[model samples]
Target: MQIVKYLKQYRIPFSGLAAGKHNFEFEIDDKFFDCYEHSLIKKGQLKADVEMQKQENMLIVNFHITGVIQLTCDVCLSEFESPLDFHERALVKFTDEDWNQDTEEVLVLSKTDYELDIAGLLYEYANVRVPYYSKCAEQGMNQSCDPEMLAKLSSEAADAEEDNTEEQIDPRWDILKNIKNN
Candidate 1:
């Protein structure tokens, strides 16, 4: 599909590189997230700096990703930008085996493969950095929840509590109370 072709820029062709350190860079934006169907991060402006060290049989890749991602505040339901800076390392091993084994930090590639597609790895790295509970006050710089929204929520809660107190009780409970008083 068109989406898959768009992400091909992340592939690194290491077959011809010498056994030394190599550097590559990529820009991540909203369109990058669109390639994924269910991406946690919808929008961001990030730069991925990759340093790959190629050896005789393996490659060690270090990723330095930095940028700001748009996140919705859980407390106030407002949109805000949260800065992201993270480092992750991945090991790619070349093997002749028929079966391919891959993990979060390790990858096994067939000897015949000439390029390593890193779009998925980059997506994973960016998504994992998001907090489980996102709040503007905590994640964003000098940011806080919306005062008007908080006030409206508190007022609605108070009104609900008042309505509950005005509800009529069963007459049997009152009879039981009177008997207990006696």
Candidate 2:
């Protein structure tokens, strides 16, 4: 059985349970990331805990995602690990008619089957927990960033801005050299 299928078994009974709070937990690791193709993550240690309260025809799922998501640095595009820490909530309602919704947090279920599989829900919440952009702290800024690359960029910009007099200009920029000093 697939890891996600674990939720399918509890569908009917859990849905019919009296209005109360229920809890579920999941562990995320490198193996989970490998399942996805071209995953940006190389390694991960995430924990997802969901608390749900059943009320009449609706279920409120509170997803708490926290841990470390091993991903490359966005700035330097180098392998780096960013911490994951966030919380999100969602509501699932059972309706007779399929209502088109405009949000990720609201879900409608069929009249026949009121049960919902939280695997997809967990995946989405985990994704949302990750910060869209994480910058390297000053201490770690240059750690992943290639020193040579930064040096090259610095030198190029410096050379462009310098007061390149005709005497200082390289032969290659003869036109530019004459425009300034001559």
Compute each candidate's TM-score over C-alphas: 0.91, 0.66
TM-score of model 2 vs. true structure: 0.66
**Candidate 2 lDDT tens digits, 24-123:** 7777777666555555555888888878888888888887887877655555555656677778888878888757873777887766774666656655
The models' CA-based lDDT, in order, is 0.93, 0.66
For candidate 1, the 10 contiguous residues with the lowest summed lDDT are 164-173
- Model 2 residue runs over 4 Å out of place are 1-13, 38-42, 129-134, 138-182
Which pairs of residues collide in model 2? none
Task: Estimate the lDDT of model 1.
Answer: 0.93
Model 1 lDDT per residue over 1-182, tens place: 98989999999999999999999999999999999989999999999999999999999999999999999998889999999999999999988987555887889998999999999999999999999999999999789999999999899999998877765454676777799888
**Model 2 — which ten-residue stretch has the worst lDDT?**
134-143
